[model samples]
Target: MPDTSSYLNSLPAIFSEDPFLGQFLLAFEQVLTGLDAAKDEPKQGLEQTIANLSKLFDPSAIDTLFTDDEKTLKAFLQWLSGWTALSLRADWDTGQQQRFLAEIVPLYQRRGTKENLAQLLKIYTGLLPIIEEAPDRPFQIGVNSTVSSTISADTAQIGGGTPHRFRITVTMKSSSTDELARQRQIIQAIVDLQKPAHTYYELPILIRTDTMQIGSRSTVGVNTLLGSIPTA
Candidate 1:
């Protein structure tokens, strides 16, 4: 239709170069162009998307796009965590989640022990974690015996709480209720994952102040934990 003369010329001279027929062909070509145009955006969009497809799955992107609607983002991340065989807390923000995604698949297999529990708590919360196994029993290590001012000896059994009872204490860098609550939730999630199935635990979070600490006080949650121990 656009090159009606060329079309007619390609055919034998016997074919008529009828104006109406040329016009009809032109309209038909216009209709085809419109149909293609209708699909062009999505089709081209898919091509570009396929080229840079990694951004869709990028863990960093998870925060920005989905953060506005928490429910949707949580749902999406749930699917991702499920695939990775990870037990993730819903409250974890973008950065923590990104870190979690970056961590190895073996973390799930490495759960259910004090070593792994403390390691994971440090990783997720960026705080020192002290894990005492059978805390009700008398302390085997000298430092382990020192109870923090926060702990109530009367409430806590001499050895621990339950048969498999353990206690975890972490000093808080921020006294803000919001930050503390968020950390508490994450800590609980990690504890839930790492603790033995039959065991239960007590989590004591202390609000640390600048006044307390120099030498031995600096090392808590590892070999030495500060209980009623004197501060330097």
Candidate 2:
């Protein structure tokens, strides 16, 4: 009100008279100019921070991570490690890890049981396991067998280890040697993780060979590869 234009015009002279005041005014002017320019367009840093915060609050945004067909589930598993309370292995496939995470509550509920062990094996290997308890018998002579007879007790032992013994027989249709080797690695990994620390397991992978179809157009007989032919 008191000659505002003249007072404003006198500011430069007043600032110039005091060097510290001039530097302070110059910095304050720069700050005001920057804020004015910021008003013309959105601040990229602030907008990006807000966008990230919005994503964190949105459930659908998080769901997109688990719903993605490829890497999302794997990433979710890594995030859920603390919540799931499971020691996840890197060698396990993403699907296997996800299944483990999904069933972790139930598996922990039934931990150390035959059902839990079988479920764990199935989750990792996609094959049902046969759990046998006390599969080994002590070798001894039978009282019913005669001492002089040629047919003795027929002492033969198969699996002798801890009371817990699980056998997983995988019958694969793949004839590729590489496939078989890969399957063995998969089986070994599953066994190492799924089995109890003191338990022993037998993973016998059997390759299935189909018989040839004999027809009028092709009458050639299939030859066996691994054994000697019987002589009549």
Candidate 3:
């Protein structure tokens, strides 16, 4: 198929002038071409098949086909994510996924630290998350602790740090409930995947209105990036 001609064209000089043989070879070549396209299919099957078989170890080479096939891009992204042990969010697009793959590996050395966690959160949410490695106060009895019969243990632990425990706060402008819920889900997933296995952290979403008022939020830290610092 290379030149759209049959290899029999190079036949022995004795048979080269055979008209019937020439016609047969040309007809057979056409049959093979149709079979190639029908059996294995075309670009679609070829792209996905290559992606599935290859481990995506060569990003530079595979990037060539990214624009050609969406399934190939997604499969490669997932393959790289599993390889790096990073549980990327489902909503992230091509650029975000690639950037995370590049950055997350270097972050492994700084895993479980405030900088590491904060950067990972930023990568997904586009906001610099506040990571309190050691909260100013731990869960205390009768002093700052709230007395409640319905306090769930899984609820975030705010204003507190205990053994292998910390708190994370991400402040954003007021948005739709659906948007907030989606952001919270993505943040939780990122924290759960990136945090130390034995460690626990509180994840609080602080919504700041345009006038710098709190919306379903508690305390505002001194390092807020969205608005002016609050003064007493």
Candidate 4:
């Protein structure tokens, strides 16, 4: 307080006497003010961009994107189509394609086995297929017979003269005409891929009744056979 006025007067004279130093101080002060005003906007924009990039590269978000839900599955498939070389069937819907992607690994693990075929049928139709193989010894006359003579019926062969034959039966509840037709197409496509090469196979679609009344006093709560569509 003793020399406050003298010190303040001396400070102004120090800068006013030097023109270059005065201009430099003025420019430096303006630069600092401008930096203070502009700093927040660029920082906010950079933070927003970093947040968006984090979400795009998040592992959990990527896993959720490929989950089994229909909408997500569709989006995943569309994205996968860019990188995957496998050809997807045009007739398969988003649900079927999702299932195919989910089960493809397991199916390949057990490929060429009956379990693989059954699994594929179950996945596509929601029904466990009844797989039947033809008689191992078509020439055998009877179960107790020891005769080994070959019968002419044994000569009969299936596809491409191969003796092996298989039959797959799919049971379904009766439904609308369009639904049944759609199911038939799905079943046919699955069977076509699951069947063995050069071997004859039959796919029979059996419709069953949900419930039936036997009489006025009795109700038979059994699934009755409706009809069958045989495919060879």
Candidate RMSDs in order: 9.7, 15.0, 8.6, 14.4
Taking the tens digit of each residue's C-alpha lDDT, what string does model 2 give over 1-232? 1112222345656645555564455333433322233433432334355556654333335444445455765666677755744556678776656556667666777776777777766665555554544334443446232222111123233333235555555555546898688767866775576567887766666544454322211212322223332321
| lDDT string, candidate 1, 88-140, tens digits | 66567756776676663556567776777777787777787777655343544
Residue 94 displacement (Å), model 3:
1.8
TM-score for each candidate, following the candidate numbering = 0.48, 0.44, 0.56, 0.47
For model 3, what is the alpha-carbon lDDT of residue 215? 33
| 118: Cα error in model 2, Å | 2.0
Best first by lDDT, ranked: 3, 1, 4, 2
Q: What lDDT score belongs to each candidate, Candidate 1 first?
A: 0.61, 0.51, 0.64, 0.52
Better of 1 and 3 by TM-score: 3
Q: Which pairs of residues collide in candidate 2? A: none
Weakest ten-residue segment in model 4 by summed lDDT: 215-224
Query: What lDDT score goes with residue 143 in model 2?
Result: 26
35-144 per-residue lDDT for model 4 (tens digits): 23333334233434555565433323444544556566566565554343333455678656655655565576776577887887676667767676654543333532
Per-residue accuracy of model 3 over 104-213 as CA lDDT, tens digit each? 88898998777888888888788867676544444565654653322233223455434677777777667999999988988888788778899877777776543444
